[model samples]
Target: MNQRIRNCAAAAGLLFTAMTASAANYTAMLTGPKEAPPNSSTGMGAAFVKFDAASHVLEVDVAFGGLLGTTTAAHIHCCTDTPNTGTAGIATETPTFGGFPLGVTSGAYSNTYNTSLAASWNPAFLSSHGGTTAGAESAFAAGLASGAAYLNIHSSLYPTGEIRGFLTGAAPPVPEPASFAMLGLGVPAMLLVARRRRKA
Candidate 1:
């Protein structure tokens, strides 16, 4: 048992060392509020976005109140990395909410968000949203591994977004596999330690 315990400990230590060697778990966040510009029937729009580095999943939550008249449509555009509305692309290769609001208007409209699809997107999207406010998770890795990403908000009146932000920072970066190795090894090490201590 002692030998087994020691072996497990050694294994765990090795794994921890390897895992700690690197880390990953980045996240970028952005919000859209009434502060949006007066482009749509309303004056502004509101939005909430969260990106998961590991899963590369993007979760979005947006609400536009005080609409000029009612809701029409909205979008996450890729305009600029720096804050403010710019002329960019719409990098929503995959979407959560394409161009429709969550029923703010009383007219014909529909929104489609596939929960199964990964919300994580390229920097182009983030730049469109706003470099300062828009956010992306795992985006840093994708950027380092590929490039950057951004976000943008738009409406019928302002088909060009009214509010925008960006996902800045090196990003949380991907977690080191070694840490996972540690977690895997640690479980056994802890079990062994507990058994030995209890044995006494």
Candidate 2:
């Protein structure tokens, strides 16, 4: 193999890695009345999340508005039997969100949880649902796919949950290893042919 072949191999490796590794996205629409303990308050919320399968990293962005009282805490809950009903264990890094000294009725919250880290799981969840971080993440991902995962926001008025919404959307699957291998071979074959053509 010559320099051209080596460069082609490197490029194919990168492409294969890129194809096999990617993130899954999920979103939710929350409302006060959607809470497990429903309320007549005019509050609402929206959440967007990305789960990186390769790294087990969960990135979340949630915004809420019009709560009847000051916001206190929030979390991602999982393994609910049905949407808009019941409560499950927290799935994010903390049971209660931090950093808010004086809670507000409306604001946005963001967080990143490494699903591979034990600290990122609610204790009860770890015990009942999954014993390890990876196991919990797998369960959470399954819940999201089945619309059993939700975002729950707590407020001073409703300490349980002022607003909530079940996460929805099936993330696209990562490419299979065989597909990656085939593509990798094809790239080198094409490169070799092109090199031969240039020589001719």
Any runs in candidate 1 off by more than 4 Å, and if so which?
Answer: 1-42, 79-85, 93-151, 162-200
Q: Which digits, one per residue and each the tens of the lDDT, describe model 1 over residues 101-131? A: 4434221122333322335343455554444
User: What is the TM-score of each predicted model, taking all chains together?
Assistant: 0.39, 0.72
What is the lDDT for 71 in model 1?
37
For model 1, where is the 10-residue window of minimal lDDT? 106-115
lDDT value, residue 83 of candidate 1: 42
lDDT, model 2, position 153: 83
RMSD of 2: 14.5
lDDT of 2 by residue, 89-200 (tens): 7877575754522378766666677778778778777777658776777787777777788888888898888878877764223334543243344333433443353233
RMSD of candidates 1 onward, in order: 15.4, 14.5
